[model samples]
Target chain A: DAGITQSPRHKVTETGTPVTLRCHQTENHRYMYWYRQDPGHGLRLIHYSYGVKDTDKGEVSDGYSVSRSKTEDFLLTLESATSSQTSVYFCAISESTGSYEQYFGPGTRLTVT
Target chain B: AQSVTQLDSQVPVFEEAPVELRCNYSSSVSVYLFWYVQYPNQGLQLLLKYLSGSTLVKGINGFEAEFNKSQTSFHLRKPSVHISDTAEYFCAVSEKAGGSYIPTFGRGTSLIVHP
Candidate 1:
């Protein structure tokens, strides 16, 4: 887990509901990323933040949003949760983007019914 | 743009047997390669990475991978395996995206170690 923690390890929600997952890191890393894991798809990046208040879209950024107000916290929000968005979400942190290995958190399992 | 491909979706091996997991990537620019292992109910852990200086990169738990530029591949290998070695492995590629680099990961290959 590398000093990273994801809140609400397990959650069951209804469709069209709003959900927010929080990732907190004690390492003070400069980079944070949000990813989803599903069967047949190892891990797909949803969004990433390079620095505080700086964010970028990833391969699968649709239906998801992210916010980074501080270096230790990166939040991922699903404005309107859908059944397709139900998956295990992982948060990763790294000191730098290049060459440096990113450390991942345990993960948050979100289920949309 | 960069993409990674892991040829096998699953690999089965016996204890103490050698095993190899194939990985290939396509990138327009120079890239960094990495291998990660994830156990059941656990987050991904870095097995090894190939940044520069060496074609053969060794990693934790007696795992190694070779970077073949001509083939556009980085395959992971281990001489002997244990039952604890069973896990899902992922291959990822990182290239310049703006001032930083973003990694693109393959689907993954599940290794089942049989006794």
Candidate 2:
């Protein structure tokens, strides 16, 4: 948990709608990550931010976008929601980028209809 | 790139019984291993990690794991488990790449502790 909070703990939206999830951290960690959890896939990183306004795409970045305008907040946006994007989304923060434990926030479960 | 493999999908054990959750990884170089536990509707909590030094690492809640470099494994064990121990466990492997160590997780193994 580690002082991380994700907005809209649960949401149900229809297909072709736009959705945004927010991750806020009080720890001032430099690294922030967005991930999605599916039944067979453990947790796939969608995107990550190393610093303010610095972001990188992960393995599963398609159909998703991220922005980190400040050190404490990272946002994940889906331009058009799809059934395939329905999953539990988690946010994690790390003090360093290497060999460090990342603290996760309570997940946001989003269901696309 | 580093990848992890959790051999079991689910394991059922009785309360107060011993249990072991298996984890293996494939890495081309030195790696760091970690175990995290997730309860129902909760975020993951770190159980233990092996960065270097000791092969036998002890973690919270009477849990321990042995780092076997030759076997490329880091398996979690507890002498006795409780019903509260029923949860999903994920194994992660990380290696340094471009000044970062973003871990790759394995499909979690659910431990069902029955009474």
Worst 10 residues of 2 chain A by lDDT: A93-102
> Each predicted complex: what DockQ?
0.80, 0.81
Candidate 2, residue A58: CA error in Å?
A: 1.2
lDDT of 2 by residue, A9-28 (tens): 99999999999999999999
lDDT of 2 by residue, B1-115 (tens): 5678999999999999999999999886788889999999998989999999989999998999999999999999999999999999999888865423888899999999999
TM-score of chain A of each: 0.98, 0.98
DockQ of 2: 0.81
Model 1: per-residue Cα lDDT over A2-107, one tens digit each: 8999998999999999999999999989999999999998899999999999999998999999999999999999999999999999999999877889999999
Question: Which pairs of residues collide in candidate 1?
Answer: none
Where in model 2 is the C-alpha error above 4 Å? B97-100
CAPRI band of model 2? high
Predicted complex 1: DockQ: 0.80
Off by over 4 Å in 1: B96-100
